[model samples]
Target: MYSQQVIDHFNNPRNQGRMENPDGVGKVGNPVCGDVMYIYIKVKDDVIQDISWETMGCAAAIATSSMISELAKGKTLDEAEKITRGDVADALQGLPSVKMHCSNLAADGLRKAIEDYRNRRGMA
Candidate 1:
Protein backbone atom coordinates (compact mmCIF):
# COMPACT_ATOMS: atom_id res chain seq x y z
CA MET A 1 0.00 0.00 0.00
CA TYR A 2 1.10 3.55 -0.69
CA SER A 3 1.21 6.34 1.86
CA GLN A 4 -0.99 9.40 1.51
CA GLN A 5 2.07 11.57 0.76
CA VAL A 6 3.16 9.13 -1.89
CA ILE A 7 -0.26 9.23 -3.50
CA ASP A 8 -0.29 12.99 -3.39
CA HIS A 9 3.09 13.27 -5.07
CA PHE A 10 2.36 10.64 -7.69
CA ASN A 11 -0.92 12.34 -8.57
CA ASN A 12 0.56 15.82 -8.61
CA PRO A 13 4.32 15.63 -8.95
CA ARG A 14 6.30 18.77 -8.28
CA ASN A 15 8.93 20.17 -10.64
CA GLN A 16 8.33 17.45 -13.15
CA GLY A 17 10.01 18.71 -16.30
CA ARG A 18 13.34 19.41 -17.95
CA MET A 19 15.16 22.67 -17.76
CA GLU A 20 16.10 24.71 -20.81
CA ASN A 21 19.72 24.85 -19.62
CA PRO A 22 20.49 22.84 -16.59
CA ASP A 23 23.71 23.40 -14.69
CA GLY A 24 23.73 19.71 -13.98
CA VAL A 25 21.80 16.62 -15.01
CA GLY A 26 21.72 13.07 -13.66
CA LYS A 27 20.18 10.03 -15.23
CA VAL A 28 19.61 6.80 -13.30
CA GLY A 29 17.68 3.69 -14.09
CA ASN A 30 16.71 0.34 -12.69
CA PRO A 31 16.91 -2.27 -15.42
CA VAL A 32 15.09 -4.70 -13.21
CA CYS A 33 12.01 -2.49 -13.06
CA GLY A 34 12.49 -0.51 -16.27
CA ASP A 35 12.36 2.70 -14.33
CA VAL A 36 14.44 5.66 -15.44
CA MET A 37 14.79 9.02 -13.78
CA TYR A 38 16.38 12.27 -14.88
CA ILE A 39 17.14 14.95 -12.34
CA TYR A 40 18.05 18.47 -13.43
CA ILE A 41 19.44 21.26 -11.33
CA LYS A 42 20.46 24.87 -11.80
CA VAL A 43 23.08 26.31 -9.50
CA LYS A 44 23.72 29.85 -8.43
CA ASP A 45 26.44 30.83 -5.97
CA ASP A 46 26.99 27.24 -4.99
CA VAL A 47 23.31 26.70 -4.25
CA ILE A 48 20.67 24.82 -6.12
CA GLN A 49 18.56 27.65 -7.46
CA ASP A 50 16.20 25.33 -9.26
CA ILE A 51 15.46 21.63 -9.51
CA SER A 52 13.24 19.36 -11.60
CA TRP A 53 12.84 15.81 -12.77
CA GLU A 54 11.48 13.45 -15.40
CA THR A 55 10.60 9.98 -14.16
CA MET A 56 9.40 6.94 -15.99
CA GLY A 57 8.27 4.36 -13.49
CA CYS A 58 5.57 3.36 -11.10
CA ALA A 59 3.87 5.56 -8.53
CA ALA A 60 6.64 5.05 -5.97
CA ALA A 61 9.37 6.08 -8.39
CA ILE A 62 7.53 9.18 -9.49
CA ALA A 63 6.68 10.15 -5.93
CA THR A 64 10.26 9.63 -4.75
CA SER A 65 11.55 11.78 -7.57
CA SER A 66 9.14 14.57 -6.66
CA MET A 67 10.04 14.44 -2.99
CA ILE A 68 13.75 14.65 -3.77
CA SER A 69 13.30 17.85 -5.71
CA GLU A 70 11.67 19.40 -2.68
CA LEU A 71 14.48 18.19 -0.46
CA ALA A 72 17.29 19.41 -2.69
CA LYS A 73 16.09 22.73 -3.98
CA GLY A 74 17.64 25.80 -2.38
CA LYS A 75 20.29 23.58 -0.79
CA THR A 76 23.97 23.84 -1.46
CA LEU A 77 25.53 21.20 -3.65
CA ASP A 78 27.31 19.72 -0.64
CA GLU A 79 24.09 19.64 1.36
CA ALA A 80 21.98 18.27 -1.45
CA GLU A 81 24.54 15.60 -2.19
CA LYS A 82 24.04 14.24 1.30
CA ILE A 83 20.35 13.49 0.82
CA THR A 84 19.87 9.76 1.30
CA ARG A 85 17.30 7.13 0.45
CA GLY A 86 16.14 7.29 4.05
CA ASP A 87 15.59 11.02 3.67
CA VAL A 88 13.30 10.64 0.70
CA ALA A 89 11.48 7.72 2.22
CA ASP A 90 11.04 9.55 5.49
CA ALA A 91 9.78 12.60 3.69
CA LEU A 92 7.16 10.50 1.96
CA GLN A 93 6.17 8.80 5.21
CA GLY A 94 7.88 5.61 4.07
CA LEU A 95 7.44 3.71 0.85
CA PRO A 96 6.42 0.11 0.56
CA SER A 97 9.36 -2.24 1.23
CA VAL A 98 9.27 -3.67 -2.25
CA LYS A 99 9.41 -0.20 -3.75
CA MET A 100 12.17 1.17 -1.51
CA HIS A 101 14.70 1.03 -4.29
CA CYS A 102 12.82 3.96 -5.82
CA SER A 103 14.08 6.14 -2.99
CA ASN A 104 17.71 5.14 -3.68
CA LEU A 105 17.40 6.22 -7.27
CA ALA A 106 15.96 9.56 -6.28
CA ALA A 107 18.71 10.29 -3.78
CA ASP A 108 21.46 9.06 -6.08
CA GLY A 109 20.07 11.15 -8.91
CA LEU A 110 20.35 14.28 -6.81
CA ARG A 111 23.90 13.51 -5.69
CA LYS A 112 24.91 12.64 -9.22
CA ALA A 113 23.55 15.94 -10.41
CA ILE A 114 25.67 17.74 -7.87
CA GLU A 115 28.70 15.76 -8.96
CA ASP A 116 28.03 16.65 -12.56
CA TYR A 117 27.79 20.30 -11.64
CA ARG A 118 31.05 20.20 -9.76
CA ASN A 119 32.73 18.36 -12.59
CA ARG A 120 31.58 20.88 -15.14
CA ARG A 121 32.80 23.75 -12.97
CA GLY A 122 36.15 22.10 -12.23
CA MET A 123 35.40 22.13 -8.54
CA ALA A 124 36.81 19.42 -6.36
Candidate 2:
Protein backbone atom coordinates (compact mmCIF):
# COMPACT_ATOMS: atom_id res chain seq x y z
CA MET A 1 0.00 0.00 0.00
CA TYR A 2 1.29 3.46 -0.92
CA SER A 3 0.55 6.76 0.76
CA GLN A 4 -1.03 9.73 -1.01
CA GLN A 5 2.31 11.47 -1.18
CA VAL A 6 3.91 8.36 -2.59
CA ILE A 7 1.26 7.97 -5.24
CA ASP A 8 1.47 11.62 -6.12
CA HIS A 9 5.21 11.43 -6.47
CA PHE A 10 5.05 8.25 -8.54
CA ASN A 11 2.43 9.69 -10.84
CA ASN A 12 4.39 12.89 -11.35
CA PRO A 13 7.87 12.55 -10.00
CA ARG A 14 10.30 15.45 -9.96
CA ASN A 15 13.77 15.30 -11.40
CA GLN A 16 12.77 12.10 -13.09
CA GLY A 17 15.26 12.02 -15.92
CA ARG A 18 18.98 11.69 -16.50
CA MET A 19 21.58 14.42 -16.61
CA GLU A 20 23.44 14.79 -19.90
CA ASN A 21 26.85 15.07 -18.27
CA PRO A 22 26.61 14.77 -14.55
CA ASP A 23 29.44 15.55 -12.19
CA GLY A 24 28.68 12.34 -10.34
CA VAL A 25 26.52 9.27 -10.76
CA GLY A 26 25.55 6.22 -8.70
CA LYS A 27 23.54 3.09 -9.27
CA VAL A 28 21.98 0.71 -6.74
CA GLY A 29 19.47 -2.06 -6.86
CA ASN A 30 18.05 -5.26 -5.47
CA PRO A 31 18.04 -7.83 -8.22
CA VAL A 32 15.59 -10.07 -6.42
CA CYS A 33 13.03 -7.28 -6.30
CA GLY A 34 13.95 -5.78 -9.65
CA ASP A 35 14.38 -2.40 -8.02
CA VAL A 36 17.10 -0.19 -9.37
CA MET A 37 17.92 3.49 -8.70
CA TYR A 38 20.35 5.77 -10.41
CA ILE A 39 21.21 9.22 -9.14
CA TYR A 40 23.05 11.98 -10.92
CA ILE A 41 24.41 15.18 -9.47
CA LYS A 42 25.83 18.38 -10.84
CA VAL A 43 28.04 19.99 -8.28
CA LYS A 44 29.65 23.38 -8.10
CA ASP A 45 31.95 24.60 -5.38
CA ASP A 46 31.25 21.56 -3.21
CA VAL A 47 27.52 22.23 -3.42
CA ILE A 48 24.93 20.12 -5.18
CA GLN A 49 23.51 22.64 -7.61
CA ASP A 50 21.30 20.03 -9.20
CA ILE A 51 20.24 16.40 -8.67
CA SER A 52 18.19 13.91 -10.63
CA TRP A 53 17.21 10.26 -10.67
CA GLU A 54 15.84 7.43 -12.82
CA THR A 55 14.44 4.31 -11.27
CA MET A 56 12.75 1.07 -12.15
CA GLY A 57 10.73 -0.10 -9.19
CA CYS A 58 7.48 0.43 -7.29
CA ALA A 59 5.72 3.56 -6.07
CA ALA A 60 7.92 3.85 -3.01
CA ALA A 61 11.03 3.85 -5.16
CA ILE A 62 9.64 6.60 -7.34
CA ALA A 63 8.65 8.68 -4.33
CA THR A 64 11.95 8.20 -2.59
CA SER A 65 13.86 9.22 -5.69
CA SER A 66 11.80 12.36 -6.02
CA MET A 67 12.21 13.27 -2.37
CA ILE A 68 15.92 12.55 -2.47
CA SER A 69 16.33 14.86 -5.43
CA GLU A 70 14.50 17.61 -3.60
CA LEU A 71 16.58 17.12 -0.49
CA ALA A 72 19.92 17.04 -2.26
CA LYS A 73 19.49 20.06 -4.47
CA GLY A 74 21.17 23.25 -3.32
CA LYS A 75 22.80 21.35 -0.48
CA THR A 76 26.49 21.30 0.13
CA LEU A 77 28.36 18.01 -0.01
CA ASP A 78 28.35 17.87 3.78
CA GLU A 79 24.64 18.53 3.90
CA ALA A 80 23.86 15.97 1.24
CA GLU A 81 25.96 13.43 3.06
CA LYS A 82 23.68 13.76 6.07
CA ILE A 83 20.59 12.75 4.15
CA THR A 84 19.24 9.45 5.43
CA ARG A 85 16.58 6.89 4.53
CA GLY A 86 14.51 8.08 7.47
CA ASP A 87 14.55 11.58 6.01
CA VAL A 88 13.38 10.26 2.66
CA ALA A 89 10.60 8.23 4.23
CA ASP A 90 9.53 11.15 6.41
CA ALA A 91 9.46 13.37 3.37
CA LEU A 92 6.94 11.05 1.85
CA GLN A 93 5.05 10.99 5.14
CA GLY A 94 5.89 7.28 5.36
CA LEU A 95 5.96 4.02 3.45
CA PRO A 96 4.71 0.52 3.93
CA SER A 97 7.01 -1.77 5.85
CA VAL A 98 7.74 -3.86 2.78
CA LYS A 99 8.62 -0.78 0.77
CA MET A 100 10.95 0.73 3.33
CA HIS A 101 13.83 -0.83 1.48
CA CYS A 102 13.04 1.40 -1.48
CA SER A 103 13.70 4.46 0.64
CA ASN A 104 16.92 2.90 1.81
CA LEU A 105 17.95 2.28 -1.77
CA ALA A 106 17.27 5.88 -2.72
CA ALA A 107 19.49 7.15 0.07
CA ASP A 108 22.14 4.67 -0.94
CA GLY A 109 22.03 5.91 -4.51
CA LEU A 110 22.46 9.54 -3.49
CA ARG A 111 25.17 8.87 -0.95
CA LYS A 112 27.08 6.70 -3.40
CA ALA A 113 26.86 9.43 -6.00
CA ILE A 114 28.25 11.96 -3.57
CA GLU A 115 31.04 9.60 -2.67
CA ASP A 116 31.83 9.11 -6.33
CA TYR A 117 32.07 12.87 -6.72
CA ARG A 118 34.32 13.17 -3.73
CA ASN A 119 36.58 10.47 -5.02
CA ARG A 120 36.75 12.00 -8.47
CA ARG A 121 37.71 15.31 -6.94
CA GLY A 122 40.35 13.67 -4.77
CA MET A 123 38.40 14.68 -1.69
CA ALA A 124 38.17 11.09 -0.51
What are the models' TM-scores? 0.95, 0.94
The candidate scoring highest on lDDT is 1
- Report clash pairs, candidate 1: none
Shift of residue 121 alpha carbon in model 2, Å? 0.9
Question: Candidate 1, residues 12-116: lDDT per residue as tens digits?
Answer: 999999888999999898667678899999999999999999999889989999999999989988888889999999999999998886444899888888888
lDDT for residue 18 in candidate 1, whole number 0-100: 85
Encode model 2's per-residue lDDT on 1-124: one tens digit a residue: 7779888988999988989999899899966777889999999998999999999887788889998999889999898989889899998888999778644588889989998988898988
CA lDDT scores, all candidates in order: 0.90, 0.88
Clashing pairs in 2: none
